[model samples]
Target: MKKLSNTVLATACCYSSLVAAQTTNLNEILVTASRTAQSVDETLASVTLITRKDIERSQAITVADILQKTPGVMITNRGGIGKSSSIFLRGTSSKNSLIVIDGIRVGSATLGQVSVEELNLSQIERIEIVRGPRSSLYGSDAAGGVIQIFTRRGAGRLTPSFTISAGSDGTSLAEVGLQGGDQNRWFNVTASGITTDGFDAKTTGNIDDDGYHNQGLHLRLGQRFDGGHELEGFFSITDSESEYDDFSSDRSDTLTKVMGASGTFAVSDMWLVNVSAGRSWNKTKAFSGSAFKSRHETVRDSFTIQNDLLISDDNQLIFGLDYINDQIDTNNAYVVTDRNNWAGFAQYQLTLGKSDLQFSARVDDNEQFGSYTTGGIAWGIPLNNNLKLVTSYGTAFKAPSFNDLYYPSDAYGGGNADLVPEESDTFELSLRGKYQDVNWQASLYQTTFKDMIAWAPSPTVLYPYRWLPSNINSARIRGLELSADYQWQQWLLSGNLSFLDPEVRSGANKGNRLARRADRILNLNLDRNFGALTLGATLHAEGRRYTSDSNTSSLEGFGTVDLRATYQLAPAWQVRAKLSNLLDKQYQTISGYNQAGSTALFTLAYQPQ
Candidate 1:
């Protein structure tokens, strides 16, 4: 694998016995890249897709479990299931990434990040991950990238699915779902529950087992009207409690909800229009030893109107307008708790001979800040029959979160209201091609961030030592990514590798590395089908990373292996088993936080054929 390429960074082994399709299918259509449908090979964006079959076959319990294996994606969790989790795409901060479910942006406005650990995979049908800045399409938080999740939808005749699982540490899961559809209408509904008595989350904390439980429901409905028009609605909710080893058996209860509706109209042969609106809420309550600590709730509302026009067979245009409002309600009082933003964007795509070009730009008027504009251009050049090169340049910006502006003064630290938005520019180049039974991609990219936020010590007369948030540092990051997929007969082999260098360019810690971002990551997967049984194995490894901006404490790198098998009992019933961390390797992505050890789980599932 070392001979493949120094900059090549991924090995995705998802498609073997789970489904017959190969990972390298160029015809797969994508919607998140440009807010419109386009084939994978035709879109000039780095993208990865995960299907429902892959999720089922992998037996992953959480959405983060599946996303961590993709190309140029990294995940860091504080502890076991339901604990705090964060994502870093290409050495960027967690706040730089955006998470979308059913086209509705969802996260916490106070914390400036999503609770990805709470999202269960049973209700998701597909996922699309686009790497690189997408602020030209989505407003803020898309400076790193965008991950769009599509929930289950009905298609054919009525069908029912039931699944149950039991595992080590008193872990259990159960889910039931029903879906039906006809030519004119479709609907899907699901209910699920999962609980686990997890291991201790910290090495030096109280010696007691932590635990987590979650309950969820999902529903989707769609109808096709006359004249090629369509209307759709979606609703999802999750309630969960997670206990960890912190302030005397500390725990938190969270309720997350998202709902949305959309209407699409085909105005003419060359014109299309879409109108959509959605809202999301994040509510959390904390407790310490049966005593209520605090409560914080975040709400987000979004609306959009878009038009797609086809000028010719080789040219297309898309323009859209978006309005967003965010509010926060917390037990701790703050001076300001709400803000609004309005934005307009347009994109153009053109093809000439063997060349492809795309231009996009957007302007956002934020209530907190004045106005910011972002733009991007991507070009594809044909090097030969088997290979193509892509080059792109983009600029992105991120607005400060509520906590960064108005957290209310505290003894330890306080927010700064005069801080400005952080900005960045990126340049990328890649080569992609297919040979024989193998498909591969290699790329290099660089990004520079200006006016980045940092927390620094601010001494006061009363409080000798204190900290405050300020726009102090700038950063430069350079990275390489490589991916390849191969299929031969009934076997599949896929892998990914990423190498990154993230450094503070203009600060006291000038040459120091960013916190919690591993410089090296590698993953490989292989699987085969035999008779009525299928077997697969995965290997994942990471390099050491710092835990503080000053690079005092660091986490050591470690590797783990996972094994899985599926057995068919009948055409509609099946049994599956998985052993994670087979070697019982002890490691931590966050200092003092303990990761899961070796564990086994068995599952029984039934679905109509």
Candidate 2:
């Protein structure tokens, strides 16, 4: 076997593979990029799809690990696995993206983020990541993009599967699942547990060993009637406990629950109606040794109704109404505990000759911020047999969280109730093509923000300045992304690169890069198959990033490699092994935080073929 440099491998592999199409085509269908089903190549937005086979092959334990390999995406983890993780998309803030599970929003409204670190990959069937603003369809918290996770459902005949794995750091994992379905009915159930005595999170601080444990359960059911009516429902829950070093040997317990039900009916030949309702709950409690310190909980309930109408063979329209209520519960007192929002949206899609056009608009009414409107337009033009051009313009906004509006006002810096919503306008242009067995996409984008929120010293205070949340900043973000994949007879190669410039345009911190956002990122993966054995390797490289707005503290760039192998023991069983951080590279995504060292895992899986 011979090894080649990333640049050389990418170029040579892509050029050589452009001879013919393979017997197996993996053209994926996506729904998160738009609210409708469309092939990946036909969607106008930058998107990435992770399927079940990819997950099993990579042997990723959490959703964060999978997302780190995607283009135009960055993650900042406070420590090792199961720690607090922040996601940055296309130079946008951590809270600017929306997360959905089975068509239902799931996250903490008070923090304006989701616990992607806690999401078990064993229960997920697919994940769709759409980059760029999407508020015209999702309403709020979509200034960056949207990530939707689809749980595993029943398919084909009855099947049972199980997996067991153990590795370094006292880590162990076990999972079992059963799925079955007929033409009219289907059901799936899964259970998983993972535990690890992780490494110290702080490099130079306390010597206590932080550890994490989690247990998860998931269930899905669906039914189909004779009159073009279908019903589906799902429920998933995860409970976890993690220890970390702060002021003391502190620990926290986290519980997350998501449940939803949906129905689709064909009202007529040209009209189809869909209705859904769901709820998500996120709760956490902190403890110092034997004493309970504090607790916080957020609950969100949502309802939606949509209608799709076909005007002609080339024209289609979709209209929908959405309602959401967010409530917070905490041991400490606060001024406000709940809020509500209602929205109405419509979209029109048209296909003319070699052009595809889509127009969308939304109107949202919030209890605290009154009414706001947003809109977007996207166009795709086919330039030749294998090339296409896409362009889009859209506007988005983010509402302030509960803690940002109603914190205590006594000794600490008080919250500001008059804060307006953060807003942005974005424009993007992309080129996509498929030549022989090589597929590639390149995109350029820019976004301008207004009324961005930040915690800064109050200007009115004279001596002792109090830091308060205020709309005191604006930003300008621009970036370029390129991704390519090539598949040959028994080998597959893929790579992606990103360049970003995220600046605070109008503020005291002007000309400074955003915190924890790297200016350059590159990722590459290569895999080969021989008989019953498969081998894979991955490389990840990231550039330097600042830790604060002043650029005083920084993290140096680093690169790491990973290796994996899988062998088919029999028709119904398989064995797999993975080595992470093969070079044992020492680096940090956040200042003072320690990452994992070299680790290995061996897994055995059983499934009926």
Candidate 3:
């Protein structure tokens, strides 16, 4: 199908043939990039789990609106849905993506990258996407994949909840929550707030915010002893203020503050341990001219440990280790710099016979780009009883940020500390099937990148470090992903299709077409359940994209439709309504930026006995 110009985003395609009609109790299905508690067909990669009743039956409020309806994911919004979003998996880039919450690492290492529009899913409770190249278990932006988000904890009994919402332009939202605990101990707490007034700024907009304000707070705690041994603790805080219109001429403002903490332990029966730390403090103020002002700060810390040994009954062994540290401070409307980093890692997983295999490798050494190594392999097969086959290969590396290495602006564009670190090699293949109520999946992918950094010109400066950043030996990308889900008895239907082909296989912008990527994307979802009433509808299609970097104007191709309804007036109470985009479909997948035509939301809930 020869067509690639970016477009390989993963996160969609789930339903392991309902693992043969789930007998339930898969350890209650909860995973944070594999800490343990297997079963999602016993994981070997390609994972997607979204719950909270699939985020309130797809009322999706952020995290790029539930990753644009999951499935071999692809999202390109430059406006609305929490504004500015970018992600691409199989096809990579978005600064080689990697995001985590709960397990920390909420992106942005000095705007190095990671923006799903600053996450907000009303304190997410579930979301796990790990498609490929996990940087051998997470090390360099996971080399193009990894999206974990697990909030809400505590289950059964004790409860408290609250919600508020308002629609259209001046949008508004509020939330409050509390969970329960009993056998052992558990806790879940949440607080949220949002405000928006944006829209109408045309001229290939990038945001002159008609308005913006955000707030967040969360906590989760758990403990258990008396044999099973376990402990957990987590915390989060976020704040934001926004208004800016990326390209040239006029208004500005951006402010952010973030905080995080994490802890996890399980000392017996196949050891497991985790530790996390985070901090993000950002400030970008500009009121008039002098081509955009600047101010920055960043701090990060990480640690991880793992195990799952059992060498018989069809082999089982998994091992792990990790560490990360980063610190940055900047002020470069002129000059000011301080950068720091350190990394360490290891991984492996194996299980044979019925099929299950995995291997991860990692290495990160950077005092300023030096030392690199990353590895991957995955295989899962069981081609009978309903078909199944999977394959994977990987390698990843990235380094070059801090405004791409020091910033100085004339309307955003500066940084080049002799940039380096940007490498990749990825491959994938898949096929899955299930009869009975229909369920299917298909996948194919390819990625190749070498020293593919960005920004360049320096041959001895002249009007912008002569514009320099370097590294672009070659580039290549390919993709295909298809998904299907069908269920009876209560009706459930799903669909997803994506295709991309990226290029720039050499120098001088080799073959062009790779900025703000998009080759083709599609999504469809429908759900219905007569009795307690649950109805849903969704459709999003995008294709046609290009935003300079030498791809030329062009950002058309559009389609949007959404409608939702939920009712469960008893046993805890619930009532929900939503209408987004409806027939208002205006377009722009990225190129100047313009999207978000219609919107609406409503909700009510209660539970107590």
Candidate 4:
């Protein structure tokens, strides 16, 4: 099956190659790839930008819905809205990739995973995904890549917007916001709420309606002074409650909050300096019936100081310092609850004779894990006016999460303090280009990991057969990615394909496929615009997957389709509708979990012109 899918994708790529409908311009100013702004086509990396227009066009309720399959990304959900979800970027573990929001890292300290499901699209302005090792630019948890989310910002004259919607499964949504900006200052404030009586999440053993509710706010203000100086500040929060089936509890309540401020100053014509600080909080409380079960909370404080300098007409340099502190507050006592990490990084960019080159390095020192260094190099050569060739190599590592090192001993298992961090090396090459209205890319890459952490039995006096986390695995992964975007007349065609081979290199399960990593993923989007009305469709397919290292249990391959439409009533009013899972497919990406059957939603909006 995998071979057949690969062959089909290869044939499609040779037919013209692709990325997406809105990406052919090559004019996007990307900031996540190199920690500095550059045109998307000029960066020597695999990157995707999802704009506000794209978000509204998709009519997606959750953030993960917008990132299902874009090159090297794969998403799995335990169930529906507000359920636990995982994003396997580059076929790496959930904890291997990093998630950033408005310059602040937000996630559970214990699990080291981001809750992408809880992130709705109403307050989001855009999303940027960089697929490759980014530890050289950001300190930790960037072995696979980095995903950055930017919230709504003010621009132009004062404007007000609101949206109300209803959907299947008793789902509902409401949002309101006011935004405005001039040359000197800007401000934006938004509030949103959503609720859904979801479907049963477990295939068997437990039959119940799992429901979820969430409310959130986003507030931002920014000021620009003379001499190319600026300052910005933002605050955002989400509170949610969800129901699911579990042995210890059946309900989960969570609160996620973030606040931050940043400033940019130009000291000289050739140099610029920036400063920023932020705090994020994540807390989860479990409940069954009316009885409270447990609680886990995480707080993160971060600060940064960076300087950008233009050495000459063809050369630029960037250097920065970062400070991060993670502290935990939980019901269960552990050995240690807090840790700090200090990092310094430098990057150099050169544009010489139509060729681009970038070099980056970073050093991080953690309170518990001592120090580590990583580096990367990238080059882009223009083969002609219509094509370009790019190559890159990088190294990255992931530190153990709090649960892996400090969880107290229990009856079945416990944490291990004497564990080493996992390390990885990646090499990539690609051919990318644009021709008039068509943009396409074909990329191939491989990554090798050492000292990967895993759970295994370790005999001891107190707990003879306790399973504890240890650095006991290694893996080798190879992948191919094909993406393309084309716009012709009134129709837009865009899509991407992901092929992954994540293998366990050294373990009792050696030669087995990496647990839960699917080998083939295909996504496509087709849209047509007719006057004031627009119509579109999305198709997503994935290959089979295993549930554990032993590969005994497996889940079959599946596919889904979504249909959407939008009609413009006026310049300031519009209506939208989406029929999700249009095929009414019954499939599960996660073992033993049940997926939502079908859902439909209709929305009306009052947006500013």
Per-residue C-alpha lDDT of model 4 across residues 1-609, encoded as one tens digit per residue? 001112222222211111233544575666788876665777888998988888889998989888884778888898888899999998987788888887777788887778888876788887889999999999789989999888888877999999999999999999999999886788889999999999998886578889999999999888877776778899999999999986567998999999999887777667777788999899999998889988999998999998877676568788999999999999998788999999999999887778888899999998888899999999999999889999999999899988888887776677888888899999999999887888999999998999887665566897675778878568888999999999898899999998899888886889998878888999999999998999999999998888776788888889999999999999999999999998899999887788888789999999986
Question: Could you tell me the C-alpha RMSD of candidate 2 in Å?
Answer: 7.2
> What is the C-alpha local distance difference test score of each model?
0.85, 0.84, 0.66, 0.85
Per-model root-mean-square deviation over C-alphas: 5.6, 7.2, 23.1, 7.0
TM-score of each: 0.94, 0.93, 0.31, 0.94
184-293, model 3: which lDDT tens digit per residue?
A: 67787888888888674354544355456788887776666654444566666666665546534344344454455544444534443445465655444544345654
Off by over 4 Å in 3: 1-76, 82-84, 87-120, 125-133, 138-141, 154-168, 187-198, 201-225, 229-359, 362-473, 476-508, 511-546, 551-589, 594-609
Candidate 2 lDDT score at position 183? 69
TM-score result, candidate 3: 0.31
Candidate 2 stretches greater than 4 Å from native: 1-26, 408-416, 455-468
lDDT of the structure predicted as candidate 4:
0.85
Clash totals in order: 12, 0, 14, 8
lDDT of 3 at 583: 96
Candidate 4 residue runs with Cα over 4 Å from true position? 1-24, 411-413, 455-468
Q: Rank the candidates by TM-score, best first.
A: 1, 4, 2, 3
- The model with the greater lDDT, 1 or 3, is 1
Better of 3 and 4 by TM-score: 4
